[model samples]
Target: MKGKKILFILSGSIACFKACEVVSALIKNGAEVQTCATKNALNFIGEATLEGLTHKKVYHEMFESGSYLKHIELNSWAELTLLCPATANIINKIAAGIADDFASTLLAANDYKKPFLIAPAMNVNLYLNPATAESIEKLKKRGVVFIGPETGLLACGVKAIGKMSEPAEILKAVKEVL
Candidate 1:
């Protein structure tokens, strides 16, 4: 994975901590990582931590000056894009072609010419909802890949299948595709 360019996107979730582990592992393996976060994701994981690990500024705003076309540039730059700890909101937005936020904009703008992966983390009910199921199907048909939201104890106090995959598992998936 040396010198591979990965666009790591983070969404709002308690599982951002797990995503951090994946970022660290990616850098350790010599993959170049750039992060773009949803506004809510930063509420859970600090910008400092992401910057410290990625060594690149996290882009979370769609209208930042001189970055009006940044999403397109990022899409062109990345060999792979991983949306870690993906939320139902973001998933639905991307499936519906909504680009209200920076992260959603990035997903919407991507034509899926490169590998795109999402690691979902949310309440089991949301994950299992018909709307989310349809959304996942929509993206999958468009060639987007999904990693595990494994069955386990959730932060919402429910032991169910809404947890994001562990870092090692996600990294393994990344390796497999690359």
Candidate 2:
């Protein structure tokens, strides 16, 4: 994955902190990472932390002055797009073609021929919900790849699936892809 361009999307999930480790690993592997975050994501991991790591600004709005096309530009700029700590909300939005927010809109603009991946992180019940499950299936059918939401303890303190894959594993997956 040396010198690859990765557009990383962060959604609202406690796993955002863990996803930061993946971002760091991507940089160490010589990949240039640009982050796009959701408003709720910043509630868990600050924008400054993402900006500091990537050395690029964190885009969380669709209508930033002088960069109204930022979301489309980001999609075109990336060789691969990965959404880590993907919450059920974001997943469903992508599946349903909802792009009301910057993060979701950027995802909607993803180039289908390019590698697009999502690593889901949410409560087990939410993960297992019919709506979320259907959304995942829809995305998979549309050629979007999904990484692990491993079975383990969750932020809510219950042991089950819907845990985002660990940083090392996520990095390995990214390496294998590009």
Candidate 3:
């Protein structure tokens, strides 16, 4: 993975913390990683932590003046894009071509020629919602790869299939995609 440019996008989820491990693993394995997060995801994981791990600023806004064309530029620069811990909201937005937020905008503007992966995380009901399932199918048809919302104990105090896959699993998926 040396010299490969990876864009890691994180969405709102309690599982956002695991994205740090994904970033660290990517960097440790010699991939250049740039991270972007939804505003809500930042609540679960700090910008400093992401920056510290990635050696690059965590982009959390679509309107940053300094990064006027960041959504486009980052896609062009990355060899792979991973939406680790992808939320149902973000997934639906991307599936529907909504670009209201930084992450969604990035997805909407992406050329889709690169490897694009999404690892969903949510409560069991939400993950199993027909809308969410349909959205996932839409994204899959568009060539988006999904890692997991594995079946297990969730943050919501239930044992079900909504947990994000572990960092190692996500990293393995990233490697396979790359």
Candidate 4:
């Protein structure tokens, strides 16, 4: 991924911390990464941490000054987009054409002709919900690649699916996508 430009989106999920590792790996391997986060995601992982890793501001608001058209610019800048620790809410909103926030709006602006990928993270039951399932199918049909919510112990203290794929696996997927 040397010199590849990536736009990484972080949604609310406990697994959001893992995205830091993903970003670090990308940078360590010579890719340029820019991050956008949901408000709830910032709650889990501080904006400074993201900025510190990427050396760029963490964008979270669609209407923020000097960024009214940032979504379009970000999508246009990226060679690929990665939404790691993608929450059920973000997935559903994207599938439903809701661009209510910077992250979702940026996702909405994506042409999908580029490689866009998501790594789901949520409770097992929520992941399996029919609505969420349908949303996944919808995105898949639109040509979005899903990494995983691999079967394993979850943050909710139960062993099942909905665990975010590890950073190494995510990096592997990103490489494959590129």
**Rank order by lDDT, top first?**
1, 4, 2, 3
Give the alpha carbon lDDT tens digit for every residue of 5-59 in model 1: 9999999999999999999999999999999999899999999999999989999
37-140 per-residue lDDT for model 3 (tens digits): 99999999899999889879988898888877998889899999999888889988988888998888888988889999999999999999999999999989
**Positional deviation of residue 37's Cα in model 1 after best superposition, in angstroms:** 0.5
Q: In model 3, which regions exceed 4 Å deviation?
A: none
TM-score of 2: 0.98
| C-alpha lDDT score of every prediction, in listed order | 0.95, 0.93, 0.90, 0.94
Model 4 clash tally? Answer: 0
Score candidate 4 by TM-score against the native.
Answer: 0.98
**lDDT, candidate 2, 48-158, per-residue tens:** 999999999999977878669998899889999999989999999999999899999999888689999899999999999999999999999999889989999998989
Q: Candidate 4, residues 95-133: lDDT per residue as tens digits?
A: 999988889889989899999999999999999999999
What's each prediction's TM-score? 0.98, 0.98, 0.98, 0.98
For residue 62, give model 1's deviation from the true position in Å. Answer: 1.2
Task: Spell out the clash pairs found in candidate 1.
Answer: none
Question: Which scores better on lDDT, 3 or 4?
Answer: 4
Clashing pairs in 2: none
